[model samples]
Target: MRFEVLILGSSSATPIYGRHPTAQLININEQLYLLDCGEGTQVQLIKYGIRSNRIKHIFISHLHGDHYLGLIGLISSMHLVGRKEELHIYGPPALQEIIDLHFLHSQTVLRYPLLFHPTQDQTGESILENEHILVSSFPLDHRIACTGFRFDEKKRMPTIDRTKTEAIGIPTAYLPLIKRGNDYTASDGTVYRWQELTLPPPIPRSYAYCSDTVMTERYLPFIQGVDLLYHEATFLHDMLNRAVETFHTTARQAGQIATKVQARKLLIGHYSARYKDLKPLLEESKSIFPNTDLALEGNWYNV
Candidate 1:
């Protein structure tokens, strides 16, 4: 279904080590869904050869400057480019206000429709769904009203067996019904079971993004068993105290969460500026969760 993630920026509060801030793109079935528009996100999008007009949805985990500072610029650029399609943004309620204030002061009105979906700070909710994927937002343990996002591929219909169906002289019109798990009755009254004529559906895959959060079990259940999990690792375990103080996570702690949640693979990022080299962070996460990888910018991770 072409479900994959492209890391745009992975820095923490400040851009360092040649990294920008936190931003990413989740491509599902050829459609692009943006998550967390940190500073220089549009530039990264351009550098990565993605069309800004192709992004229909933007998900912001919080209103933190490092997380959403690039939103206004991106929006303005989209407007300047003459985009006319509606743009949907999912985030905390105050995010809309922030966006509105910026546009209002600049005396600029977007040519495209701006739709804001507010995420509850206290509870999780289904924010978006389409024929291909279901997206949900869950509360995260952060200094602000933060939330993590989960994208689950929708269950696919059973595959129709063309050999069996054609052998039985079934019309093409009935093929869709077969895929939908419906039995077919031949003109002669022989009943063909749908189960016998179709292959089992493929297992759905999932990806979760935990933008900026401290180590806590509160969000574990929401993201459990994700095929690919993106978690913030703002520091190493050596700076565990600072991580806790700032409501951020350490690489070791991120690995622990990945293990506790039983994630198949973990992508750790949101690196603090103090780190010039991210290999140590990757090594620390790999210590506990051997399937962990660093969320390096410009890299696409398949789900």
Candidate 2:
């Protein structure tokens, strides 16, 4: 199984010449999970060669225009393209109303089913789960009701030792129970321990996404020790005061959070438009957290 993230847009509220707003595509076990559908996200997806039909789940952090202005357009395009698969959207309370109003005014009935799952609380909890992975959302300190998401893969089952089984003349019927950690007792009273016949399961991988948040340590527990973390760094250290005033985070602040959480790697973005060059921001973040990298548009990070 592969887990990867593609940076679709990195610019902040103000649009830059070639950059769009905040959006990302997270692919886990072949399922596409979209985070923050910023303006021009569909176009970006097309540019990156990502098929829109693969996106089954979309997560919005807040109601900011820069974070979700492209949602209606994306859905409309999906409908026009004759998408018949059900789509699930997770966001704050008002998101359903906003999309409903848009569809109502346009009199466009979607060709596929749209399911809205609203985030109503602050504490971190699992929001979506399947056999292979689980997704959890936690509250973040922002100007509006915002949340961050954590994606964790499920622990894999232990691999069987085929050589041991063959040597012992074990029937293929008992392989299933043996792989599940169950000891198989032969007809002659020969006992085979599961631990002796199987190797340990692989460690699960995790990724966390935090967007448009202020400096807050409360999220450390939820995102701790993730393989990769994507956090917003909208300003440089010089604009710490402005970051506080606007409820955004400076590059250094984002690095500090990544350090506190002990993340393997950190990617920071949602840059303020005033910055024509992001070298300073990247340098500032790297000064605190050496593994930090700028969230460049069209770049892919494997988790």
Candidate 3:
């Protein structure tokens, strides 16, 4: 099962140098999910050779232009190319109105069905779930109503040790019970522990995306223990006042939040355009959380 995130764009406010905005393409169990379709995201998707049609779901963090400006373009492109599968979008309620207005004036009806799911801004709640993963949206401390998303892989079932079962001539009918943690009894009255007849499954993996949020503890519980965390670091600590006023986090503060949440690894992004050189931001974040890495465009981070 492949679980990774491809950074499409990470620059904040505007595109500077080689950085774009805040778009990420997440792949989990071979399904692709798009997060935050910033301006030029469609172009970045093409540049990265991503098959956009495979992405059935899109999650927008907020209504910020830097976060969702490219959505119309992407949808239009999908329509132009004749997409037939339904596309599901999860975002604030206002996002549905925005999308409707764009297409209304353009007189464009998509060939594919576009389903809009509104996300809550007051509390964390499961917005989407499948056999492999669960996605929850939680409120963030931003100037505007914003939310972060947490993707958690479902717990896997333990596998049967076929060699041991076959050696003991255990009936196939007992396999299900053994998988359910029941002890297996032999005809001679010997017992085999479920743990002894099975191999433990891999630990569930999780990833969290925090876009345009200030460093606050409000969303900490929702993102705790994520295998990979993508948190916005719009400025350096030297501009802490600016960061607080803008409701954005500094690089150093992002690191602190990652540590507090016990993130296994952190990818800091949403960089302020003022920074053409991201080395300082990476250094600042690493000071507090040594596992921090810069979320640069075109880079993929595996979970």
Candidate 4:
């Protein structure tokens, strides 16, 4: 039930001002998912006390060096550490080739199986799913083929009222039906409504990650209503032209996007190295969206 994100790094392009590049670890229901293994991510993982072996899935937004330059090293470390569990990686189509070439030249055969999933640059699509969560990848406006990820918790079954059920002599066989919101019929032909036997299920939670992308309306629908949103704000509003030219978003624009999506919380990061102090960027974002938080390195944001 622990759903949180640990930001490993927050700088953009290069490490500076005590910040590393872009890397994040999202933990949901005890499973780990790595987002964008930028340079020094392995070291950051160690510094943060996160077990790298727990990372079964890695999602790369693009081929940008600051976004995923540390991937090969991480994968290689997993091999050296004797990892046997299969690892799944999702990213642009060319990512597999890049990883393959790295391993080929290094003459490294992974100790575990490696699977690559290519994200479609066209639209939002469900790329991974399990009983507890569903992960979808959506295209983002960027200079290269970039995409964002949405993590949504699955709908849970209604909580059964054990006291009511027992008092009504409801059989164990009917529990599943009750949880599914179906009325249960007794042997005497009496009907017990599901509402009378159970409480409503908790609302599902969701998180969205958008990094290395430009401010565009196309991503609005995909990220709407997320409990927590991590959007890149690589520059301040004063550098708007530079941000636009580089296909990156400014702090002010990032906050506006969060407001438009009606997100509960917005975490802005991927700061430009030129910014030794992020106060100005944070202030600009908060002016538009008051619920914004700076995505600082080693910080954990719960959803």
Cα lDDT tens digits, model 4, 1-303, are 789999999999988888999999999988999999999999999999988999999999999899899999999999999999999999998999999999889899898999999888798999999988999999999999999999999999999999999999988988998898899888999988999999888899999999889898998899999999999999999999999999999999989999999999999999998899999999999999999999988888999
Clashing pairs in 3: none
User: For this target, which candidate reaches the highest TM-score against the unseen true structure?
Assistant: 1
| Alpha-carbon RMSD of each model | 1.0, 1.4, 1.6, 1.4
What is the per-residue lDDT of model 2 for residues 1-303, given as tens digits with 9 covering 90 to 100?
Answer: 889999999999977969899999998888999999998999999999998989999999999999999998998999999999999999998999999999999999999999999985479978999988899999888998999999999998998888888888889988888888899888899888988888888899999999888897777798899989999999998999999999999999988999999999999999999998999999999999999988999998988
For model 1, how does the per-residue alpha-carbon lDDT over 191-294 read when each residue is reduced to its tens digit? 99999999888899999999999888888999999999999999999999999999999999999999999999999999999988899999999999999999
What is residue 104's positional error in candidate 2, in angstroms? 0.7
Instruction: List the candidates' TM-scores in order.
Output: 0.98, 0.96, 0.95, 0.96
Model 3 residue 235 lDDT score:
95
Query: lDDT for each of the candidates?
Result: 0.93, 0.92, 0.94, 0.93
What is the Cα-based lDDT of residue 130 in candidate 4? Answer: 95
Model 2, CA-based lDDT: 0.92
Candidate 4, residue 213: Cα displacement in angstroms equals 1.1
Q: By TM-score, how accurate is candidate 2?
A: 0.96
